[model samples]
Target: MANTPSAKKAARKIERRTEVNRSRRSRVRTFLRKLEDALAAGDATQAQAAFQAAQPELMRAVTKGVIHKNTASRKVSRLAARVRKLSA
Candidate 1:
């Protein structure tokens, strides 16, 4: 339990931030899922489009502090490679 008013407020703030971060994370995952689906379907054009769309979402999450920069970069790199391989 929160003992003081300040502690209670902090807890409330944390909850709010958690919700926001969760939403951000979910949004990123949704974008990734779209890309994944496109890749799984083996539609190079659709996958390329999805990849283009997903790249910014990943970077946006990074900028928003929802994900680490390197993590986002690595994801982008791997996905780009998959997209390239599919296209080639």
Candidate 2:
């Protein structure tokens, strides 16, 4: 369908961008999942470590437009709360 040169170029760019974004999103989710698993396992130390690792990745996702800022904030807040409860 991309008959024009510009359109063809755009298609290629879109494909590349899609792959990059997909990988970023997947990596973010993997971090989140690790945090969740740590929490579920009731290991405060592991959960804290996972949370520490996930926080920056989630923020990066927000900065990269993969996730909303508030969503990331909410996730971090909730995870932090859970970790705090474990520490208490």
Candidate 3:
């Protein structure tokens, strides 16, 4: 509806923010997927490197409010554990 001027402005702002958030989330997921693919391919060194690359992106997603802190932490933990298993 957004009949009020303020409401219309807010709606526009929300649309812009949604796109930005979606892009950030998508970028983070791309990093995670790359790490997962490296792990699945059984390349320990590549997986380790991919995890290192993904860690900061995931943390940045949390800082930017695109993801929750705990969720990001859990993902990083699980990925690190998998990378460790690969190393062993």
Candidate 4:
């Protein structure tokens, strides 16, 4: 329970930030899922395009503090490798 006015305001702020972070996380996941779906379908061109679209979103999530920098980079690297393998 937030008894103090300041505490109540902070709680409200936290609630709003939580919603925003959740939305950002969901958007990033959607981009990742699109890339995964394209990869699973075995379409190299589509996968490449999806990866292109997702790479920036992942990085953006990192910048927004929604995910870690190394985590985003690792995911991008792995996905790029898979896309390259698909093309080859």
How does residue 9 of candidate 1 score in lDDT?
100
lDDT of 1 by residue, 12-57 (tens): 9999999999999999999999999999999999999999999999
Across 4-81, the per-residue lDDT of candidate 4 in tens digits comes to 999999999999999999999999999999999999999999999999999999999999999999999999999999
Instruction: For residues 1-88, write the lDDT of model 3, one tens digit per residue.
Output: 9999999999999999999999999999999999999999999999999999999999999999999999999999999999999999
Indicate whether candidate 1 or candidate 4 has the larger lDDT: 1
Q: What lDDT score belongs to each candidate, Candidate 1 first?
A: 0.98, 0.94, 0.96, 0.96
RMSD of each candidate?
0.5, 1.0, 0.4, 0.6
Q: What does the lDDT come to for candidate 1?
A: 0.98
* Candidate 4 lDDT for residue 23: 100
Candidate maximizing lDDT: 1
Prediction 4 TM-score vs. true: 0.97
Off by over 4 Å in 2: none
* Global fold similarity of model 2 (TM-score): 0.92
- Give the alpha carbon lDDT tens digit for every residue of 1-88 in model 2: 8999999999999999999999999999999999999988999999999999999999999999988999999989998999999878
- Candidate with better TM-score, 1 vs 4: 1
Worst 10 residues of 3 by lDDT: 73-82
Which parts of model 4 have CA positions greater than 4 angstroms off? none
User: Residue 87 of candidate 1: its Cα lDDT?
Assistant: 100
Off by over 4 Å in 1: none
